[model samples]
Target chain A: MSIPLALASGTGRFYKHSAKIIRFARHGCTNRPFFHIVVMERRKAQHQPVIEQLGTYDPFPNEHEEHLVAFNFERIRYWLGNGAHLSTPVAELLGIAGLLPIHPRTYMTAWRNRRAAEEAAAKASESGADANKAPESKEGGSGTS
Target chain B: MSFGSNLRMFANKASLCCNVNKVTLELFSRCSTVAFLQYDKDPGPSFSNPDVQKLLKSMTRVQLEKVYKKRSVSDNTVEYKFMTSEQLEKQFRKAAERAEKLIQMPPIVKVKEDSQKVISRDPALTNFSNTKFVIADITYGVNSSDRKILVRQTDGTLEYAPLSIRKRINQIYFPHPGRKIRLPRMFEPEHLNRCLANFQYEFILDRACVQFDPYEKEYHEITTKVYNHINESKRFDDLRSTRHFGPMAFYFAWHQIIDDLLYDMIKQDYLKNGAELVALYYQLNGIDYDKSIHEKLETLVQPQSTIQSVLKPKASDDMHEEIKNAIGKSAEDFTADDISFEFIETFVKTKALKKVQLELALQALRETNDEKKKLYHGLKKAHGIS
Candidate 1:
């Protein structure tokens, strides 16, 4: 008989169709933890778990960094696909990790940077055009003479 | 004139200053004791008569000098600065020019009319009441003919107007029409309230933490204690009764955390939904609740132990080092946004998270990058960016 299994903080629930594993990664600052949950296969080991990453779970850590923890991502996705239910928080974490395939035009730091660069380039070209125009106007007058 | 006549004229002038009251003169004559009083060895005799004492008191050295100076000045020839005839004529001409300018100006006629008159004349003037229209200073004349009132405003501008009897009555009786006026709002109160609730909900969801208080009479308390015991061996401070460690403090701590969360949210999206929350909270609960209770709630719920541990310089040093390694730069090199600055200040001051100072510094560097990008875009727009 298959037994019910929940990983990480028990935020995952198992349903008849699939089991969802909420995986989180504590990656940012030492005491500041950021979590992401990923659904993976329950049969696999913790590190080499074969499944798609589902989501993240991050509990803000204390100063000593003793309680910092992270969850396996690949196994979480595998479980989610098979039939695993996620809680609200787990679902949100997964959405942020891009495992759920959200809106393509989501606001991201990289997009902002790209737009800023394009604007900067446009400004430089406009000024360049202005500078060139002044010289060209003077040349036109000289040619007329 | 004879020398005796001239001496008599001088004596008459001198006597004018020393003349006593007629009654006193008569009393002096009747009283042969006046000589004894005058020659009395004691000055006390003069004090017996209040009039004599008053005269003697008034004749001080300063008073005498003032009198002599007044006489001397009156007797001397006085000099005056007299203007020449041409100078007088020029001054008179300027005065005449100014007077002519003043006379040429029209008289101020206060239009003691009601709002009805003004409304009938100009519908736009209905915006105001108790209208006392001042006929312009250059108005040559004012007359009402065929229900039309003619007015010449200052600067030689003439206006043909109609009488507004309704406005005139309004001005004379009910001058204030504030009861009928209605104003438009940019955002409805209900809409604003909903927006605030949404922001508050998101903020709470993002930052709210559930911790097991050892003092709580629940199984969670025992589990938390066991967890703490297994995690570390440091002596924990018993903050059961402390004002900064209890439920109230926890509430306030959570409030501050949520405030920071909202700040981060707005920075990411530029939607001041948090401001709407604050406004709605005030509107529903009043300023007292927002300023006192809400503010206190944030302080009460804060995790003082974690803050205290983080703020400790020795404890924070290692954390700072780790942060530096992660970011690959010094925290001092970072520049933060206004919201981040406020968050850092509040978090450090209340929670005493000394390590956060380094985090703030790193965040500041990222903020600088953001600002530079924003500035570059702004400049590009000014240059007509495509």
Candidate 2:
């Protein structure tokens, strides 16, 4: 005798013209992260079975340090044309692919990171000068001596 | 309708009690000074060098049962297989391959900090959305670490998202079990010391490794805190034989506080391991040690580090001596205790350690080695074997 399991799967039932969203379904073991981008009914939970898998997003860096993503642009464009709403993450990906404008937050991060790096560099040089007079201070002035 | 309201009240009461438990289960952390990497200098990158990595892996002393303990398998299906002797051997080989994969500890790199890069400032797109939109490049074939993530702010700035937001985006798509979208209660400043006080070193280290990227600042803070506590308490063996030992040992060595650890290693009769520790110290400080002894250390250390085999091209290159002053800058702090004059002619006779730097390294190895040798022979002699 066989019993049906309740694991998340596509039910193979959907209204033909219903709204959908392309997004990720989490997969992989604890501490090991992987994702499958799928087109599913807009109202369903993320783990719900989807109409089709469009791509995968692997957040862990490969040895080459690339966050690999695999998606069918044709299928993605088709879904978009058919009035499927794009999730923020999906929109971000498309932006990176030259399909849309670069996300504004990416610009913000680049600037923030740039500022942090500059501040660190400046601190390093100042600390180098401080090192010149450190021997006199002798193990730093700490505690009420 | 009354029954529904009653259920809602019960739920509300249950949630309130849970919040109370959370609030009372934790307290604020003391702003205890960090001992490891306290000088605004990185203590971990020292481990990236092959030699310290080798020593760390050896010190960790991997025991398969502890490292590869069974997980709660989600799959309930069970299949039985009949196999010939040869087939069973192949199965064992496959299992061993998986074991090798399990012990690969996370790498320690300086947190990746980059300068601000402005892509564009389109005020026209201002007020496009009140909420921020995080965009991740899902281009197939890019490594996750290198994959660029961008975000759009409410003020019409389309630039790179900060590391915090990027980590959130990563977790949204690829969630790690037990990792929360927001900071876990244990990681809050008030709760951190409470967890550390329980000496939950292994659990804290393991969770942090999974929850944060190795290069993230939070990861370093948590790891360094644990290492410092272990050092302060003289409980150096707490992280031993686990993946945590790699970074912890490197932290001690880089910070030049290996005196206590060296004493322990020597006293434990892990002389070869002690020698490797010395080698690590010398390498970090550019101490001119005997090259042949270095080779001996290489032979002594079994290559159990499956993760580092590829990252170790700088075996003999100590060209970074200028910045390596942090190591070995302080005088030896541990005493040369219980090592009889007898060792000067035998173990320390190898001249493997420099007289100036090593009065500390050779402190207790000979005594322990003799003790173990005598014990081994006594067992043999009791059976009438010469």
Fnat for each model: 0.00, 0.05
RMSD (Cα, Å) of model 1 = 49.9
TM-score of chain A of each: 0.30, 0.75
Model 2: per-residue lDDT, tens digit, A16-53? 88889988877776788687777888988776667777
lDDT of 2 by residue, B1-386 (tens): 11122111224444544554432312101112332243234545675767667667777766655665554557646569999967866765665567656667678777766556556676544444334445565444555566666655545566776677667656665566777878777887678898888888888888898778877878877888787787667676777767777777776655545655656666554555565666666676555766465454344344445333323344443423212232211111111122222232243444322343345545444455455455555554554544
Model 2 residue A145 distance off true place after TM-score fit, in angstroms: 56
* Stretches > 4 Å off in candidate 2: A1-145, B1-46, B68-97, B137-143, B146-148, B297-386
Listed in order, each prediction's TM-score against the native is 0.15, 0.55
Q: Model 1 — TM-score against the truth?
A: 0.15
lDDT of candidate 1 over A57-125, digit per residue (tens): 335423422112222344554465566656455553333333453222322322544455556666666
Against the reference, the lDDT scores of all candidates come to 0.32, 0.58
